[model samples]
Target: MSDALAYDVFAKTCPSRGTLEHVTGRWGGLILGALHEGTFRFNELRRRVDGVSEKMLSQTLHALERDGLVHRDAQPTNPPRVDYRLTPLGHEVAGQLLGLIRLVEGRMDRVLAAREAYDAEHEPVTGRTA
Candidate 1:
């Protein structure tokens, strides 16, 4: 493999950009975090992840699976059972993502305060002339 291929994410034309996008998208983080706990059915995942549409969930799952981060198991049963879980690679990344989540949660107060200060300074004064 070429040196450029070693870190393809930096390449504009590399496919890793799509993979990175999939892994870091809004629904992707939540889905990975949910699966970190254990395997869950489609409905269960949908419930675990709030405000995710059925189509979005399916698309995210498919993306994750294609990237080899998620495992989909189809059981041979009466109604056919399907479960989704993280692969070893998924677990590793999930742990990192969870840590990031915790960091944001812990610092939310500071973040909010900063946002408030910024807005206070930036908001246009109704009585002031530009």
Candidate 2:
């Protein structure tokens, strides 16, 4: 067997942790999910990912590209057009993320009910919970 050490996500200093954070950040997952459908231009991506500011989207794309999970293609046209798509690595990760998204969506009702129950049980005597 090879002596290569396997990556441990729980390790404090593991490089994968940073990558994990990048891939699963507020915008990263959405960006990857959108890209899974196919390539999209910058504006198209922004439109698809509602509520993401242009600055945040640009930053997220740059980070994903740096991590080799996204491919950005720039075309030299009258007006430069940049297209974004998922790399093979990104496709795999996005698939897993989609599964997670679906799971959370499917269970959101349960989560909401749990929250309501917890809030009701923990309601303050003053009726104003911090």
Candidate 3:
């Protein structure tokens, strides 16, 4: 008889334990969602998203491309244009990703309210200033 294969996400030592964090990181999630509509030129993407530095964007793109989620195209043109798009696999992953986003958006108000209440209830009124 053949041995059964196994996998678990709970153990911190698991190789894939950090994968979810990587795929769902601040830049990764946003970049994937943005690329869903269509390919975007480097500068156009920079303008579309607020607060992402150019270097970070480049690095994020490189990571996604390495993971087979994003495709980078550099055209031989006068202006030297480069754009990014999602692979078919990326579409599947990104759709699941959007699900997480929708979940967050639906419950964000409650989450924020809870955080506010926690802060108000826990703040030291007359404790150490620093």
TM-score of each: 0.91, 0.91, 0.83
Every model: Cα RMSD to truth: 1.9, 3.0, 3.6
TM-score of 1: 0.91
lDDT of 1 by residue, 9-63 (tens): 8789878899889888999999999999999999999999999999999999999
Off by over 4 Å in 2: 1-5, 127-130
Root-mean-square deviation of candidate 3: 3.6
| Global lDDT scores for all candidate models | 0.95, 0.95, 0.83
- lDDT per residue for candidate 2 within 1-130, as digits (tens), equals 1433677779998778888998899999999999999999999999999999999999999999999999999999979999999999999999999999999999999999999999999887786577
Residue 76 miss distance in model 1 (angstroms): 1.9
- Candidate 3 lDDT (Cα, 0 to 1): 0.83
Of candidates 3 and 2, the better by lDDT:
2
